[model samples]
Structure formats: C-alpha cells, structure tokens
Target: MSEDNPHSSRGSASKTWLERIASLFNAEPQDISELEHIISEAANRQLIDEDTKGMLHGVLDVSNMRARDIMIPRSQMATLDIEQSISEILPTLLDNNHSRYPVVNEDKDHIEGILLVKDLLQFAFDAEAPAFHIRDLLRPAVIIPESKRVDALLKEFRQKRYHMAIVVDEYGGVSGLVTIEDILEQIVGEIEDEHDDAEDADIKKMATNVYQVSALTPLDDFNERFNTTFNEEEADTIGGIVLHAFGHMPERGESIELDGLMFKVSKANSRRLLQLQVISGKPPTATEQD
Candidate 1:
C-alpha cells in the first residue's frame, strides 16, 4: 500500500473548504462530529486565521489560570441549601444553566459539597424516598489555592475527572468555585449546556443608548452591534482592542479610553475578557478609528 492514500494521486483536489479540513482528522479515532463542530464554530465566528487558531489551541493546552482566575465569584454562584427539597430545586436548575449546585450547611461559607442534578433525579421523582438532608447527597467540594494555573488545573480535573474546584484567597479562605465549563470557556467561548433556557439573550440592547451584553460577545458582533469604527487589523474585537490598547494584558474592571470609546472591562481574567462596557456613543462605522 502507498504511504499516503493509494486511491488518490500524489496531490490535492479543490474540495470545498470544510471537506478538505475534514480529511485531516481521523474520522473514527478523533470523532469527526466534534471536528465538524469545531470548524463550524470557527467559521461562524469568522476566525479563520492560523494565528488566532494557534493562540486558541495554546490557551486551551495550558490552563495556566488560577482559581481566582475564572471561578464565578460567590455573588454569581447559584447554590442550594441542605434544607431545599430536590423537588423544589429541579426547576431552579433548569432556569439557572447549572447541572450542579453547592449544598451548604449553615450558609455557602460552610459548603458541605455539591449536589448534581443527575444524582438527585431519582429522589426528586420517587415519592417513597424519606426526607433527607441535602448533606446526605453532597460530595466534598475540591478546594484549590487561588494561585493555581488553568493549564495544570485542567490536567488535574482530567486525571481525577473532577468537575469543580473551590478557590481560596490569600488568607486561604473560601473564595469561589471553578467548574470544568469555566476552564473550557477559557479556551473556547462561552459554552451553554442543555440547562440553558432557549430564550436567554446573550446580548440584549438595554436601550437605544445601552446594551446589556454578555461577557462572551465576540469582537465582530460587538462591532456590528454598536456601528463603531474599530480597528481590528491588529486585533479582532473590542476585547482585543483593550489588550492592545493597554499595551499589556488586563483583568476585569480595567479601562482604556480609545477615540472616545471607553472599554471598561466588565468581566475578564488573566486568560481573556468575558465582557466589556461599551460606553454610550454614536460613532460611525464608515471609517477606522485610531
């Protein structure tokens, strides 16, 4: 047999873009479905360059993020109490885009462990089950120091197959928890699971002068949404603009005034931005801005 494909000539054919890339992946070993999903996502994102692709791959390979890096702060975490019945919480889970919730004893501070919706299903559905403390089904929350890197954490999670890790601050006190999805979002964009409602708006135009947008809004979409003349030659979106404008990477709440548009980083991490505050402005998109 030939070293390469014996049926074809020692050359390439002008197949459509996707088909060619598809050939590069092992259909069985690599899961062609995921391959198609990645390319489709990339195409939808309008990110076709080798550079961005390489950067994305690199970021994903090394989750060099700390617990303070990506954990949804306690204020943002959706949790459950040991007293809350599973029957009452299932609907809440469906609405909150969460597969698991922390089961706290006294409060979230005294988190006993996590309660996965899957594990609680039978109890919620079974009428004969005795009343039990949420603590009964809780799994000890994995705790990691705030300084952990995203890359190493990903490996740890994969090895132990852990889904969540609590982050501790300088005082070694509970800060927040990081989930598998949170780490993955560092590599890719926001990932909505089955629990996400169909009607949630990722980006909402709050008013004629405002937009309550998600942190994960892509650069191109922001450009289109605001009708602003942004320079994407060096970077692709407003988040890119912030990184380039600061002349260094930034964290959440960092602000950069560029051509009357102040990008107040509404959300970010050492990895990248999650959301930005696009100040109210009426700029034309007809010309590029410096």
Candidate 2:
C-alpha cells in the first residue's frame, strides 16, 4: 500500500519527526507569512515568533539568477574558423576540451554552423576521403540575441534539441556562444570533458589561505571555492571586475587594483583578457597605486 504513495507517507513521517524536534527545542513550527497576515486580519490572533519570521525571509532570498548574471562576455569566447583543415584544426579543437565548436566564416561574428568532432572522427578512421571539409559535417547553428533570458534559452535548447547557441550582440556581431555544459556548470559545478587537456589551467595550490589561481577561472567558480560569494551579489567572475576597474577593455599584463585585490592580466587577446591572477589576501586600500 505504501508503494502506491511512497512519498506521501515519507513526507508525513518526516514532518511528524520535525514537529517533535521543534517541541523539544521549545520552537514553534508554524509558518510565519501566514501568521503576519492573520495578525493583520484579526487583532485577537497572536503572530508567530520574530525569529521564525526572519528565518522564512532567508529561505525566500535564493531565487534564480538571469543569463547576464553568469554569461561569458563576448570577448572571452573561443571559436573555430571555417577555412582551417581537419588535420590542422583537430589539435586546437581537442585542446579546448569541447566536443562541438562553432564554425565561423572569416570572423567569429559570422558563425556559419556547429561542427561536431565525432562526425570527423568516423571519416578519419575510414580513410575513404582525402580530406573532409568542416562544412560538410556541420549542422545549422542556432543564433540568438544577447538579451534572451537563460530560462528562455534553456527552453529553446530543449525544444530544438540543440546544445549550442551563437549569441549576437545588438550590432549583429558574434557576442559569444553558450553551451549546455556552460549552463549546467552554473548549478552543479564545472564539467571537464576528455577534450580538456589534463594539465589545462588547473590552478596550483600554494598555501591553504593563499594559493595560485588561474586567470581563466570564472568568477563564479572562484567565488565559491574562496567563499567570496561576491558579498552575495556582483559580477559572476573576477574577469568582470578587471574590465570594470580598467575603465576600458584591458590588455594582457595590464594590472588593476581593487578592494586590495591585484588583478593582473596574465593572458589577453586584442578582444579580451583571457586570464588574471589574485595577488594578495587583504583587500586594497584607497591610496594604493594602480
């Protein structure tokens, strides 16, 4: 009989245990927002305890964040060019640790489609063709504007049964690309695949409190591991602050000081800085030199 409604019995039993534990601790288990409404509705009814009401508010604080909250800025995206050969492109494609790469014409701004390495691998083993063109193996790339919400993007990915999107900025230039792995990393954690090189950007731990962190570490992952949580709100990665601190887009090795943190651009391209290093444990002082 319990098998038919297993969760029903389990939940009821758990609630009963919790009610007893509440009594043992001299705590009331009543919901608070309802208590507030009841007190407002009738003068005779006493409201729940203040502590319980405050605790309820804490639970309500954790709502879902937006796409912009965790998006990789357009400058940081790694893309593949269409003209590159199968033999020439394979090393780079494998090194990035990505299974699918966005195929662009001459500029990343003009994404042609998505190329799956798996398709090329089959022909590589067969030795039937002298060379395989990336265009022949690619599927039509899905393009979306930057303003689209992550919730909407996830739904679109599901509906279309696709995993990658070419993000276009307001000017119709390639903004960046977001993958299902990127979205999933936001919740569970970073997901590394076989394509990712083992020695790749894996930070070297120097000290328990002070260690070396990679410039490419996303602000999201860095915050969690270090317990910054960005004071519970801010740019999702350290990279955001570097861009903000410089007052302009930064170049490789351009160092900026903020809140006692020295973010030095360890790696950069003409478009964006690829990596930064956190220099100290203390926050920056106002008089500190740039």
Candidate 3:
C-alpha cells in the first residue's frame, strides 16, 4: 500500500473545520430574533467583533424606527429667516455652527428653501461679487413624511445624494428635520468632530456661570470642580443624584435646585438623563472673591 500523505490528512481536517463553520451560517434565519441569535452566536465564536455585532443590531433596529423617532424637533432647530441680511444671518450661522440652514419666512412653517454655507463663500472671497441675496442661493428642500421608515430614508438619501431633509406631518406642517448623519449615528453611535467635547470630559463651561455637564459625571468630581458638598453616599453620579432629587424621572427642560446649583435636564430619552445644563449658584470661589 502507498504511504499515507500527511499533508493530505491535514488538508482534509482543515476542510472539515471550514464545513462545520459554514454549516453554522448556512441555515436561513426564520425571523429577526433568530437572525440576532445567529449574530450573537458568531460573536461568541469570535467570527465577528463586539462592535460589529452592535452595528448589526443597530441596523436591524433602524428598520423598525421612523423618521419622527430620530428627528430634531422644530423648537430645537437652528433656522435662518429668509428676509434677514447677511449681517444678521451670519451671527445665527456662527452660533449654531451648521453647514445648512432652513430659510424660512417669519414662521418656521413657511419654509422658503435650504441654504448651503458654501454658496456664500464666493461673496466672502471675491471682491467683485454681486450683492448677496439669500433667495439667489437657495436650494430646493427635500421633504419627507414624519412616518417614513428610517431604513428607507437612508436608502433614499444614498440614492438622491442629499444630506438633509425636512420632515412634515400628515397635515403638511413641518414637524422637524432629520439628516443622513442622524440616521447613521444610530448605527455607529455618536460621530463626534473636533468641535465636540472630548468623550472623557465630564463638564464643559458653556458661558458665564453656565456649564454643560455629562449626567455620568461622578459626584466627587462634580464637588471638586464646583465647590459643592453633595453627599456621594446618596448617589454615585450627578445623574443618580438628580434622579433621586426629582422623586421621579424628569423630562427634558425640567429644572431642579440642589445645594445652590440649578440643574436643568438638557438632553434625555424616555429611560434616563444624558446631559444637564448647570447654573452655578454657589458664592464666589476664593479666586473670584480675590
């Protein structure tokens, strides 16, 4: 008999392992839950990473969500008045730091068109440019229904090559706006740029005596930064302390006073607080006193 080839045996073993792995993914998942189970199984087996697994689930979640679910409410939108001169418009643009603005009449519901910041750059650089007219540079705004599915909206965004859309209610009233980035954020989590506060920072000074604070900031850290004696034993984080003081879950814009500090819920979801606008009420610190 011919001597058995050792290489052939090793090759056969490798092929067998691959087939077993292939079988794991061969079956069609029966439903969303089944598909999630398959993805979880793959993660457990080290076939895919934890981050990839989360994104896969995010994609699945996005399919069930609507435009209204992630839209920036009308009250919070940064818009420009169509009748404003460049001098008046520039301040609002600079403060909001947005690339696009909805050009509206006196009422936000009366949206004129979208203004792209790049269109104004010609006036800034060219001395011989014609007088700036907001209407001359307006781009047609894309409108979508508030009930539009997020996944479908994302597909349309990709196909149309547009970044932003105005969302409207059933009665044709502008409810809010949603962007491609907002939908993508659901998949990849928050996409922070240089202007955004560093992820590790707990508190950021917004303006005179006003600060934007992460709800997750430790009570000890808050005390050290602001010269307060809030008891850490009662709650570990500023969020926990606020929750305890509220006696119930507080919605966005709700305000509370604790230990000379004014805490206003700046960002929150139905489940928990995400951020707070804190106004310092404590007596002047030693440096300020001096």
Candidate 4:
C-alpha cells in the first residue's frame, strides 16, 4: 500500500498533459479573427504544424472570396471558335495547351459549350476514326454568377463532377471563368505542373508581334527590350506607368496606347495588374469616311 503503483502514476501524468492540451482550445472562438488566433497558438505549442495552420487560414480566406475575385478574366481566356474547322482550331489548342476550352459562336460572350482536349485524342491518333463536328463533341458549359461564393462553387464542382464554369455579371453578360483548380489553389497553394512555365521571364515573346510582359518588369528593362524611351522617373515599372495613365485601377481587357505601343491588360486582380499583352504597334482601327 505504501509503494505507489507505477501504472497509476503514469496515468495521472498522461491525464494532466491531456488536460493542459484541452485547455488551449477550450474557449470557443467568437469570430474568425479569434479562431485564427487560436490556430496560430496551436501551431506555436506544436499541436499542429505550420503547413496545417496555413491551410486552415487559406480555407478561411476562400470562404470569404467570390468567383469574380479569382476568375480568369474574359480577355485572357483561350477559347475555340465553333465555326472553325478542326485544322483551324488545332493551332489554338496546341498554343494554349489547356485541358478545356470554351467553344464560342462569334465572341467570348457567346459561349456555346465546353471542349475537352481528351475528346480530340481519337482524331489525332486513330487513322480510321470517323469525321467529327465540333458541335457534336462539345459538353454543356456550366455558368455561374460573378458573385457566387468560391466555397459553394467548389462544392458544386465536386457534386457535379465538373472542373470549369463560366462566370457572368448580373446583366447576364459573360464576365470571366473559374475552375476547380483555381479554388483548390487557394486551399493547397499553387498547383504547378509540367506545363507551368518554370522560368517566368519578365518579358517574353508570345507571337510575331505580341509579347507577354510581367507587370513588375522594370521600366528600364522594357525600354531596352522594346527599344523605346519611357521615362523611368514617372514610374519604376511598366504597370505603374499604365496605372498612372489610367488614373485608376484598370480591369483585364482594357488597353492603352503608350509610346506608340498597345498595352493590353491580360491578367489582373482587384489590387493590381499581373500581366500585360503588349503589341509592338498600335492596334488597327477603322478609318472614318466622310
């Protein structure tokens, strides 16, 4: 009776440790900020790893974000023209290297359906495959409002087994596009693959006269690349110059002529521009006849 039971002593110590751990999360978080604080505290105490804590925060961030916040703006969308022949559309498919493309009738606003790249594999590989029509191969496109919640859209994506959705404004006009991958990126971070550009050069040639320029590219670098004298004193980066010229934040698809060159906003978010598609010369315009 005098000798303490070893098992009982060990059990008592385990109970004390468990109680201490429980006390850390005992208080219910009154708000998201409070919950975030608790998550951070858990990470501090080694209850959860830093990565887990970050993912939890990302989940919270996604809950508050909407389709408009992350959707790829219409101008940057790689689409297939429904009227184009298979041979004509092949080049676009190859250049863009996207798994899916929105089949549009005449413009981005007139989406017909979705085309899966896999569906074209038979035509490419099988010599005996029957002639196919683009209309016959298209799958129905899912359309969602720009204000749709990212979390809710993600849930729908899972339930419906679809990966992409066309985002529309309140006026029922095509706004942009959102994908399940985009939503997942918010949770697990950027999901880069083999196709993703490993070296994201600030300025890179995309076509004969079109180039993709990073918004953060130094003005000096752009001047050197394009052989133009843009005053660096006004702005350090090309994006800054464009922003100054706009007098406000510009949305994707907006274009401005600078130093005789056309700079089209290709990729952007609410806060700032991310990428620009620069044309070496001013875009062609129709002449007004008297």
lDDT of 4: 0.80
TM-score of each: 0.58, 0.52, 0.69, 0.67
Could you report the Cα RMSD, in angstroms, for every candidate shown? Answer: 10.5, 13.9, 6.8, 8.2
Collision pairs in model 4: none
> What is the C-alpha local distance difference test score of candidate 1?
0.64
* Candidate ranking (TM-score, best to worst): 3, 4, 1, 2
What's the CA error at residue 92 for candidate 4, in Å?
1.3
Candidate 2 wrongly placed segments (more than 4 Å): 1-64, 194-290
Better of 2 and 3 by lDDT: 3
Candidate 3 local lDDT, 1-290, one digit each (tens):
12498888888877865665475457543487767776787789798899998787777778777888777667667798988999999887776567899999888798899999998999989999889779989999999998999999999999999999999999999988998988887787556565565423567655568776878889987887789888999989999999999999897578999988999886554446767889896654553311
Instruction: Give the range of the ten consecutive residues with the poorest summed lDDT in model 3.
Output: 281-290
Q: lDDT by residue for model 4 over 82-107, one digit each (tens)?
A: 98889999888766668999999989
Cα displacement (Å) at residue 76, model 2: 2.8
Q: Give the CA lDDT, 0 to 100, for residue 167 in model 3.
A: 93
Q: After superposition, how far is residue 191 of candidate 1 from its true place, in Å?
A: 1.9
Off by over 4 Å in 3: 1-30, 199-290
Model 4, stretches more than 4 Å misplaced? 1-30, 200-290
When summed lDDT is taken over every stretch of 10 residues in candidate 4, the lowest stretch is 281-290
User: What are the per-residue Cα lDDT tens digits for candidate 1 across 85-131?
Assistant: 76767666765656778877666677778887787777667999887
TM-score of structure candidate 1: 0.58
